[model samples]
Target: MDALDIVMNKDKAVPYYQPIISADKQEIEGYRVSGKVKGEGEKWIDLHPFFADNSIPDDYRQEIDDHIKQVAVSKYLHENRSELLFFSLNPNLVVPENIEQFIDRLSVFKSQGLPFEKMVIELKEHQFEGDVSNLKHFVQYIQSLQVKVALDDVGTSSTQLDEIALLQPDIIKVDLHAIGNSPFPSVLTEVLHSLSSLSRKIGASLLFQNIQEFTHLNYAWRHGARYYQGSYLSKESLTFLDKKSFTQALNKDFHRFLSFEKKKIKSQIALTDTLTKRLKNYLNNNKDFSDIDQVTKEIASVLSDYSFRVYICNEEGIQQSGNALKDEKGVWQYRVEERYRNWSWRPYFLENIVRLQYEQKGMLSDLYTDIHREERIRTYSYPLNDQLYVFADIPYSYLYEKDFLL
Candidate 1:
């Protein structure tokens, strides 16, 4: 139905609950309340489009939104539910003028036996049109009432990390649908990792939505997601479901994910061991570290099957030897221009150097995109001495060939 139809029949607007499953408990932690209107043949038509449309009058949309919340809240209280009730609020509508009115409405619910602590208000910060400081104040006020705030559609378009850090919402909702549709999915891994790190630092829980398959669920689990939602686990319903509905299934899936991750870690450790053994054998046979260029080329040749490029650097991250690069035709070539380049600005450069020094062993890095190759790859770094370190770039093609390496 069109906006006019939905608006004209606003009384038909009803709340549907989508179950949110917790990663730790492997059970339904809460339900995200969404609007659905009774349409032709008494079928439930989603009101997301109507609410998302900016051209519609704010008052008209607000009326329907408020109605849905009232109905949902009454139903929740009647059922005596203890789980969290997530209500999505339009950030544009939450201005300073109407802020108190909104709080008063929540207070009315609190008077009706609904606990403020169980209420979660989800806001899409990217859609906020007014001054962010105002929105921040509104969130702070609601949180003061013991109501939790959740930033919705994070890690998507126009969601800035600075704003997230500033607002410091209690939960950050990431849309897995966006990641599945991204052209460069690998880039999103970095984005999710950053989001994950930010959430941990800020003490916010992560809720991943639109999870439609096992891969999406696994992605959410691996990226530190605390809560999960979407059709993969359960569909939105007119009534609340049993809290333990998906416990058995989630446990089975978690087992599979854990097994796969363990295999990947074992693969990385085995590769590190193999590289250390070969490097130790080569170092025992040849001791002339002064010929840096020749030494790098020899090492690259010895590990050519695993690495596409090899280089030596000092503890200060200054390249001491030229890059030994493998050509498309499998010929090894030395690029002396790369020598003397300072890599101290790179992430984990110094930390890995220190780790290598203290551990006195080889280290395998997490998967990342290589700027030069424009491909997903891993770097294996080994300490040659206190002052020098050798790094080998493992190509994406090789990792893809190995089980659980990619």
Candidate 2:
């Protein structure tokens, strides 16, 4: 359907609601409203293309948006719905002049029993063409009305952390569709995990959308998503769904996810225990710490099955021993230049060192991409002594062989 056709036939435009389910309650928390136009026969054409088309006049798009909002809000109020209502706002259209008008429209809905607190405005920050400070002010003004603001399309498109921080939205929306079927899923997983951490620090809830499969749902759940939205749970519809429609199904899926995560954790713990035992045995046999290079080579040989590289670091994260790395022929070679390198600048280097010292146990680091190899790997850090720690770099090949490790 043409944008002009939808704009001209304003009455044909309607609202479609996609349910957003909560992780904690495993129930429908709200519905994200999208515009659809009644097409030929019984089909409804999505106006997403029309809205996304920058060529379309702002007023033409806004008219259809208004129609959908009015119809959706009316239907919601008539049904006496208690769940939240999420409405997408174009940051480009959110100007100083029309902001008050926008708030007034929401105020009208509030007066009609739909509280401001129940309304969530999702803004695509990356698409915003206006000044960031102006957008920030607009978000602040609406938020002042007890209305929640969500920064949409985070970790997708061209969104940045600075924009998110500046907006300080009540929720951060991450679309799983962007990471679909990527060969380097580990890289994307790390990015999502970083976003999750940022969300926690900023006190914003993570809402994962476009979850079209069990893996996507599991990804969302594992990444600390407070809410989920996608075809996997419920697709967009003309009418509202039961609040607890997905509760039972979600509970079952959550159980499976939990069990799988537990298995992964157990595998990690088992590996850690195995490494600790091996290290203890090696230390018992080699009492002389004078030959650091020889000690590293010996330990690397002992852990040849699990690690491709092994080295020793001091309490301050300075390399005490040269890196004993495995070659293509499975021969261990010492890289002397790797010694005396300061690893304190790396993330969690100091933190993990502290944990190793306090726990006096081997710690398995989270899977991350190695800068040198450009492949996902984990580091096993063991406290060799009060002033020394042994680090082992487990290769991706080793991790790939273990089902739970990856």
Q: Assess each prediction's global lDDT (C-alpha) against the native.
A: 0.91, 0.89
Candidate 1: global Cα-lDDT?
A: 0.91
Model 1: weakest 10-residue lDDT segment is 176-185
Which lDDT tens digits does candidate 1 get at residues 1-406?
8777887888888999999999999888999999999999998888898888889998878888888988999999899899999999987776778888888888888888889999999999998988999989988889998899999988876889999999999999999876664233887889989999999999999999999888888889999999999999998999998899999999999999999999999999999999999999999998879898999998998898999999999999999999999999988989999999999999998899999999999999998999988999999999998899999999999999999998
Q: What are the per-residue Cα lDDT tens digits for candidate 2 across 1-406?
A: 7878888888988899999999999889999999988898968888888888889998888888888998999999999898999999887776656887788788888887889999999989888887888988998888888999998989876887777877899999998887775343675677788889889988999999999988888888888999999999989998998999999999999999889989999999999999889989988878888889998999998899999999999999899999999999988999999999999999999899888889898899998889999988999999888998999999999998997987
Those runs of model 1 whose alpha carbons end farther than 4 Å from true positions after fitting are: 1-11, 181-184
- Estimated TM-score for each candidate: 0.96, 0.96
Best by lDDT: 1
